[model samples]
Target: MSFADLGLSDELLQAVEAAGYTEPTPIQAQAIPPVLMMKDLIGIAQTGTGKTASFVLPMIDILAHGRRRALMPRSLILEPTRELAAQVAENFEKYGKNHDLKMALLIGGVQMGDQIKALSEGVDVLIATPGRLMDLFERGKILLTGCELLVIDEADRMLDMGFIPDIESICAKLPTNRQTMLFSATMPPPIKKLSDKFLSNPKYIEVARPATTNINIVQYKVPVTARKKREMLRHLLRTDNVSTAIVFCNRKTTVRELAKSLKQHGFGAGEIHGDMDQSSRIGELDRFKAGEINILCASDVAARGLDVKGVSHVFNFDTPWHPDDYVHRVGRTGRGGARGRAFTFVTPEDAEAVQNVEKLTGGEIPLFEFSGEQPAEAAEAVEEKPKAQRPRRARKDEGAERAEAAPRQEAKEARSEEPRKERRPRRSQPEPVDDGWNGPVPEFLHVSALV
Candidate 1:
């Protein structure tokens, strides 16, 4: 159905049309009507199902009539991460262009003075991360008393990041009669408890099963050694005509290292992670979205809530630690009605992790082989070779052999000699005690003097 049929205001519809979204996604179709009716909502859908717009549209319409008071926002949106919060803010900007609305983004890694100023000026809409929101609330910089609507996006991620307590505190501060909406790609038990606590007779709308992957994405796993991952990634990028892509790593260090390696290999690459400053992260993302960078290496911090269009591919440079994270990583691509491809790099040790992901997705991901690569033969050859012929000895014998042979014996002895000084004994100090017979002692001394 078209966006107009969803009971959105003309201004919102016009904005949607101007933004080139004529049709509503499945989640949007189900979510918008109930939200526009001012009902509490619990929406469960997979990533890349247009869940962001499902709430963004209705929120813009609902917030259109209200005027914000100083330190009291009309609506509050709680996101899990800075990137996700920024993305939601962008959505509000894009869809609420026709309306005279102001939004303040309160997240970490930036100066809080500006956010405090924005809150003081009375923002119509406030999008903030749970931690930053709680920080401001506790500091008496923002108030939730005037908030008429609340949206908790990516509820599961918030729980995963250990923000449930903060969310609970924030909920307690808000008016109990406010409309609350919670959306998630997956609904674990904690998330359910959260919904049960916050939502009152809510409309439950689920577009798809939890932890589901997009069917349009062709998933594949390329088995390689941990040390050979970069080489294999370089090979894959060189072979595939990757127009634009996101490469997911499990750690921030790996993200930065991989981005550097990719750039050194003459690829247009950038990096984003939780460790980087907010401006740098946003700048990198802007460059990637603008097509200035062909590849972006990032941790799961960039996985959810980012709406970068025209991503032709996704590469899991490191297998996700959690099964749910796999869905978000690949879902970065295959968005906006576009077909995308995702390739995951799995090592021999990651077999169990890969199987768990497959079980979570309820299907086996197709196996892929690099062209002109001889991994099996190489492995077999290494296995067939005699242990004595191997260049590096097994780890079990490494330390023992070193200890026995003592090749660096002289150096070891020299090092030990410098530290032969023993620890000094602590000196005992005398304790003072009160004598009860001070006057008797003075008499005894006088008697001795007389003697």
Candidate 2:
């Protein structure tokens, strides 16, 4: 259905059309109507399902008539991360172009003076991270009592990042009569409790299964050693004809390392993680979205709430520790009705982790062998060194002169008549060689008898 059928104002529809969205996504179709009707809403959809526009369009229409007072916004959107909050602000700019809506962003790692000035000028919409929002409230620079509408985007992510308590405190400060909307890719129990506590008679809209990956994405598992992940990623990027892709890693260290590795290999790549400064992270993302970079190596911090359209591929350098993250990581691609590809690298040790992910998604991920490649006949077949060529020093040295001379040298040194022999050597002596044929000794015998 079109935005017009969703009961949005003509101006909002015009803005949507200007933004080049002719059809509303399923989440948008189901959510906009109830939200515009001033009902509390709980929207659960996978990532890349156009969930942001589901609420942004309707809220812009509802907020068009309200006038905000200084330090008091008429509407508030609480996002779990600064990148997500900034993305929501961008949506407001795009969809609210026809309407006169003043929005201010409050997130950490930015100049507080600029945010304070914006808040003082009065904002119709306030988009903020939970921590920074609470900071402003505690300093008496922002008031929640005047808030008429509240949107908690990525509710599950907030819980994952330990922001639920902050959300609860903010909810307590806001007007209880305000319209509340909570959106997430998954609905964990804590998120449900938060929704129950804050929402009144909420309309539940779920477009996809919780923690499920998109079907449109062609997913594959690329078996490779962990140490060779970067090389394998580079090979894929060079051979797969990727247009724009996001490479997800489990750790911030891996994100940085992979991005640097890609850059050194002449790939147009950038990195984003929680450890990065806000400006650098945003700059990298802006470059990536503008086609300045073809690859973005990021942690799960970039997985949720940041919308970058036309991503053709996703590569998981490290299997996500959380299965829900696997869904979101792959969802970064295959967005906006476009078909995409996703490849995840898995080592032997990561088989159980991949199995857990498959269990969570309720399907077996197809194992993809390198084209024209076959499994080795045995473990030794895959080893670089031939078995016959492997060093046999232990067997060769058995009963050799060095072995016999070792004990004789010790005895000779111990029986020396030199007065200096009374002083013990500070250096440790060599250990006796194990014949490799005897059964393993008890731990206490090895420890006490050896000493």
Candidate 3:
């Protein structure tokens, strides 16, 4: 269905059309209607299923007529990461452009003064991370009692980041009669418990199974040694039809190293992980979206909320420990019904990890048989190469040199094998001494000499 059929206002529809979205995604088609009705909702959908627009589109209309108050926003959107919060803000700007709505973003690694100013002047919507939101609330810089709408996005990520307690506290401060919505990629036990405790008779909408891999993504696992993972990745990037891709690594160090390696190998690559500050992360992402870089090496931090469309491939440099993470890592690709590919490098030690991922996805990923000689066998074959023959006189001269040098080598070895004893130094003869004052020697000196 189109955004217009989703009960969104003409202004929002115009904005959405301008943003190049003609039809609503499944999640958006299902959730936006309930959201526009001001019902409490529990939205369960996988990543990259247009979940942001599911709420953002309706929110712009719901908040269009709300009155703003100083220090109290009309609506609140809680994201678990700075990037997600910023992304939601971008969506609001994109979809709410036809309407005039004041929006503020509160996340860490930025100046709080501007956020405070935004809050003081009163904003129609506030997009924030839980930590920064709680900090601002405790400092009495913002009030939530007047908030009429609340959206807790990526609830599972909130659980992962240990923000449930903060979420509960924030909920307690908000008006109980307000509309609330909780969206998550997976409905784990903790998030379910939080939803039950917080949401009041929420409408449950799930477009897909929890932790399920996207069917559009063709998944494969390449059996490779850890030392040859880079080689496999390079081979795939060179041979496969990769227009843009994200390479997932479990550790930030690996993300940095792999990105550097790819750049050195002449691929347009960039790196993003938790270790980078907010500005650097945003800059790298901007470059990626602008086509400055075709490959992004990232940790699991980029797995969940990042929404980049038309990604041709996803390469997992390391198998994710958490099975659910496998879903999100591949979810970065195959977005918006586009065909995509996912290649995971599986080492001998990662057998269990791959098994867990397969169990979660509910199917086995076909192994990608490397077409050429394996890395180990190729190296060994090169090392075992035969050498060319030398002249007979050269061989004879070599043998003669060794024969002549053998005795000296044996003598040196024998000397080194023997233990040496400590020797006493020889004493030197004493020299006769002459006194410079021979003519007038002191009486004390004469007595001393005689004694």
Candidate 4:
């Protein structure tokens, strides 16, 4: 069904049309209706299924009629990361343009003066990370008592980041009678408990199974040695006809190194991770979205709730440590019903981690062979690569030593062929045998000298 069938207002529909989204995604079609009715909702859908818009669209309309108060927001959205929070705020600006609504983004890694000033003037929507929100609340810069609507986006990620306690505290401060909605790709027990404690008779919507990867994405696990991961990645990026992609690394250091490697190889690549400040992270994302960079090397910070359009590929430079992250990392591609490809480089040591990912997704990932490399005789032996040879410097050093030893060996052989002599000569020597002197004895040893 079209978005019109979902009961959105005309002005919002016009804005959506201008944004070039004519049809609503499955989650959007299902969840928007309940959200418009002001019901507590538990939306379970995989990443990149239009879940952000599902709530953002309806909330704009629901909040349009409400009056905002100073130091108190009419609606609140809690995101797990600064990137996700900023993304939601962008959505509001895009979809809420026709309507007169004010939104403020609250996140760490930046000055809070502007945020405090915005709160003072009052805001219709407050998109914040839990930490920054709690900080402001303690400082008395913002109040939750006036919040009429609440949304916990990516609740599982919040759990992973240890934000559940902060969320509980935030909920305690908000009015209990307000509308509450929780959205996630998976429904873990903690998220369920949070929903039960907070939401009242929430409508449950599941577009797909928990921890399931998107069907539109073609997935494969590449068996490569740890040292050759960069080689394999470069080979794929050149041969696969990638338009835009995000390469996910497990560590911030890896993200930095990989992006630098890609740039050195003449690829338009940028890096983002938790270590970067908010402005730098946003700048990188903006560059990626503006097509200035085709590849984004990122940590798990960008894995969840980041919406970049037309990403044709995702390369997992390192297998995700958390199985659930595998879903979101690949979810960056195949967004909005577009076909995409994802490849995960699995080293021998990553067997357990890859297995956990497969177990969570309920199926084994197919093995991918390099374009020109010969397939192994046995698939199970894919990880058993030949040992790497010694480095060039070590080999060169050994060659130099061998060349230097050749002259010494020849000199020693020449000396061995010659007659051997005593290391030192005696001070005086008697000539041949028993008193028969073949050579003169020393004068000092004579008996006449003694007399």
What lDDT would each prediction earn against the true structure? 0.87, 0.87, 0.88, 0.91
Per-candidate RMSD, Å: 10.5, 12.1, 8.6, 12.3
For model 1, what is the error of residue 254's alpha carbon versus the real structure, in angstroms, after optimal superposition? Answer: 1.2
Flag the better candidate by lDDT, 1 or 4: 4
TM-score of 3: 0.82
For residues 1-451, could you state the per-residue lDDT of candidate 3 as single tens digits? 6677778888887888888889888898889888888899999998889999889888999989868999999999999888888889999989888998999999999999999999999999999999999999999999999999999999988887789999999999999899999999999998999889888899999999888888899999877777778887887898788999999999999999999999899999999999999899999999999999999999998888578878999999999988888898999999888989999888778989988888877889997655665556324322444788776753467788899999999999999989988687755534435856457544454333322
Error of 4 at 286 (Å): 1.4
lDDT of 4 by residue, 182-293 (tens): 9999999999999999999999999999999999999999887777788778888888899999999999999999999999999999999999998899899999999999
TM-scores for all predictions: 0.83, 0.84, 0.82, 0.84
**Reference-based lDDT, residue 341, model 4:** 96
In angstroms, give how far residue 216 of model 1 lies from its true place. 0.9
Residue 389 in model 4: shift from native, Å? 16
lDDT of 4 at 299: 96
Q: In terms of TM-score, which candidate is stronger, 3 or 4?
A: 4
Instruction: Tell me the deviation in Å of residue 263 in model 2.
Output: 1.8
Q: What TM-score number comes out for model 4?
A: 0.84
Residue 41 alpha-carbon offset, candidate 1, angstroms? 0.7
lDDT of 2 at 357: 92
Candidate 2: tens digits of C-alpha lDDT, residues 135-238: 98899999888999999999988988999999999999999799999999999999999999999999999999898888789999877776676767877787
